[model samples]
Target: MRNLRITLIFSIIILTISCKNKEVKSENKNSNIGQFRFIISDTLAYGKNLARISEYNRKLKENESSVIAVIIENELEDGSTKIDTFSDGLKTPFFGISKYQTGKHKIEIKVEEKMMRTKKLPNDSLSLEIKDIYYTYKFHVFIKDKVYISELNEILSKQMDIEYNENPI
Candidate 1:
């Protein structure tokens, strides 16, 4: 009888502790958990532009969030595709160490201007054009050593679309 009472008391204490600061988790895709984001210079990413690209990769390492972005072509209603990114963050040269973020959260960004791209021609003619962009993603979250997880692949992440120059130069 004493053992049963002790076990019941202990279980209540554990349940009460677990209720604090609980994360909203779900296994569904619409569960709002798997979103992640990062602001990477499109110039360095593509093989086209070299002049505007910095040796900055060797000089300075960005405080890059661990979100791998998979951009796809945006299909328009007219059967034309456009890169439709509009960024509202501070348009600054990508620099400085970003702040550390909590795991399983996503980055949300508001855009003040639509993002665009520019091309320099062989005869020094500059062709400026806007790209229609769309994105899909794969997720990877770095869990700390002491953390526990009931599910791994279903983990979600997010980041703000800040510090990216629309047309890098």
Candidate 2:
């Protein structure tokens, strides 16, 4: 009987440690900003002719889709800023362009709850399920040279930060 009691106590301690490890793994997964690829095809082109190309992959539920929210701030030669905001999905490669030509540009990309897609269910119903899914990502890029593609690509590529977050509901 004494041996049985000791065995049970040891098993309980092991079980507790296992549970704690699982919890820690969950937290790490939530905080992880996975990898992505971003390239500016025409980095050396004029500001208005420049284009952005990127790709990111994520597993989503049947009722869910991936989206990207972007904010672009371009500083003109006269010291004024042009701001643009738009949203797009990640099911395919992302291609985008800006309409300004001179000065510097700051680009910010976010992937969060607000990027959620709203779709009607088969029976025209809506349901919510609480799941342990959290994704948060932020990517920043700066464009300074709008003249030579090779040089600008080298400079802008060095300034790219391709982290993003996603916590879907």
Clashes per candidate (backbone, < 3 Å): 17, 12
For model 2, the local distance difference test gives 0.37
- Please give each candidate's TM-score: 0.18, 0.40
> Which regions of candidate 2 are displaced past 4 Å?
1-35, 41-43, 88-124, 128-169
lDDT of 2 by residue, 37-135 (tens): 445432234454233335455666555433343334544556576665433333222333443443443344332222133345688554332222223
**Top candidate when judged by TM-score against the true structure:** 2
Candidate lDDT values, in order: 0.25, 0.37
| CA error at residue 51 for candidate 2, angstroms | 3.9
Point to the candidate with the largest lDDT: 2
